[model samples]
Target chain A: MTRARALLIVPLAVFVGIVVLLYSGFGLGRADLHPSALIDKPFPDFELPTLAGEPPRRSRDDLVGEVRLVNVWATWCPTCAAEHDELARITGETGIGIVGVNYKDDPNAARAWLAERGDPYLFHIIDARGDLGVDLGVYGAPETFIVDAAGVIRFKQVGAVTADTWRDSMAPVVASLQAAAP
Target chain B: MTGRTVLGITALCIAATLASAASLVDAYDFDNPALEARYRTLIAELRCPKCLNVNIAGSDAPIASDLRRAVRRMLEEGRSDQEILAHLQDRYGDFILYNPPLSPATVLLWATPAILVLVGLLVLRRLGSRRDAVELTEDERARLDALGAEDP
Candidate 1:
């Protein structure tokens, strides 16, 4: 081909290539934004004081021997409040145990909020400093992690747990994990 | 009528904002100036996972503050910079780093600009080598006229 023709082809190919690259970037198709570092691994080990007046400490060891959900929530997080009823329904309907991490929230406010909304958590793991949430790779509140009987994280939902999410992802995984275990 | 009061308030507001920004860096004082400088640089290197675009140093997000405290704790314990980076990476993945390591996934990100530049230079050289439409020489023109007369 002539030099001019080849040069034209070069610009066209570069433009097409960039277009393809950006188009495929959207192929994830609405999966939660953050790429979790904790999926398929054990949820980070943490022992936090309970929000119900501190004597009853909750730890990773307590979560073992059962498939359960660990939810990170705080009174300050509006989305957490919105998802509270759905969480309560999930807890009531399905027998899946849920552990709550009250991340970076005041103990009194957390207790009041949970009390007002009706506490759905099996136990509250009060994390006032967010140290435990950091370990769990929590950038925002309302993240839920599904742990297998062996304490391995099977799945993580990065945003609020709505009915659709519970039905589509969490419930199915929880059911299978429960069935897989004794 | 109350211009002096408004001016006083403006000065106080500016002072307050400056103090707030300063406090972000000052809250956790390092044992030495070198350690403090490193802390500042490290926070600047890390992103606030919740804040999206801002670095952890400039972000007021609670998660950013938490990560800052973690970095401080790690530094105080004599952990190396690589160790601290690895720890955050293990928890937050490569997103935490402002400059992620070159890996298979990021090859395009690191190489695309270089490839484009090379293509541009090659195109420039190609265009440069072939001199501007070699001014049709006098002999070539005479030959073209002879060929045209025969056809006529």
Candidate 2:
């Protein structure tokens, strides 16, 4: 038809097309929140039997009042196998105690994992039943949590821990925690 | 349509119908609402690595169903949300998350959408402005003048 009519028609068609796409779930809009966005929140709670029947080494109480690195790991997880050495170096050399959560792994394998790599943790908690791991929002092994002295979670790393990442992202988090404490 | 075409369409419809039942049947018993809700959240966040398209929550694969049950058990036993997620993340990589955390590998996935949207808007604005600024052709203007004269 006329030029003015064509112009009005094209924009109206574009608007209607956009509305249809949005209704059909094809919108270009972004949803920033996802399930993994729960990091830096309070750690979930659980009390589990410690490895080797050595008594319950960690609980909600242990997470409170310190800047601790809680590493969730299992012997079966391949990434955990890969990151074990880096974890040992960071915890051993840097004097940052990595609290190990032996998640859903066989007790014997758990012991062997520590024996082969040498235990870098101050204490290791057995999550053979996976109860504690679930409490801490652990989806898999080698997940790390940075908990402040006040029990507020500062950071939650969803993958294997590396020396570079610990130095870069986690060290600052630790410093922030120390500053906030007392 | 041919007979073969009709049969194929029917088969496709049957498969589509079966998919929902297969997924629901896989979910294990959780009498408690709290435990079931936690299990749902856990499964939705977990990717069915084998399936690739569906989350563990929506997948009918036996392994995904088993993982769903295991998640429920963890919740019933009093594991926290973080602990449950950590358990899965430990078994799977960050790939389990539909949206992985902002890491070196994942930064591109997170950032690309916003950047692309901004670029798209800029392109649309330029195109719209160009369309708006164009003058009518001589023939179109003459036709418009005749139409305007006729209107009065």
Which candidate has the top score in TM-score?
1
> What CAPRI-style quality would you assign to candidate 2?
incorrect
**Location of the lowest summed lDDT over 10 successive residues in candidate 2 chain B:** B20-29
- Enumerate the chain B TM-scores of all models: 0.72, 0.72
Candidate 1 per-residue lDDT over residues A1-182, each given as its tens digit:
69668767876897999899999987864335456677787877887788875567877898888998889998888999999999888888887888888888898988889879898888888888888888888888888899999999898888899999889978899999988998
> Candidate 1: where is the Cα deviation over 4 Å?
A1-31, B1-23, B136-152
Provide TM-scores for the models: 0.79, 0.55
Chain A accuracy as TM-score for every candidate: 0.85, 0.75
- Model 2, residue A117: distance off in Å is 1.4
lDDT of 2 at A10: 80
Native RMSD of candidate 2 (Å): 10.5
Clashing pairs in 1: none
Clashes of 2: 32
Question: What are the per-residue Cα lDDT tens digits for candidate 2 across B58-93?
Answer: 776654655676677678889998887776675455
Taking the true A–B contacts (Cα pairs closer than 8 Å), what share appears in each candidate? 0.68, 0.00
lDDT of 1 by residue, B77-145 (tens): 999899998888877888889898999978999998999899889979877877775678899999989
Model 2 per-residue lDDT tens digits across residues A37-150: 346567667676677567645577865777888888888889998888898788777677677788877988888878887887868778776555545545556778887776
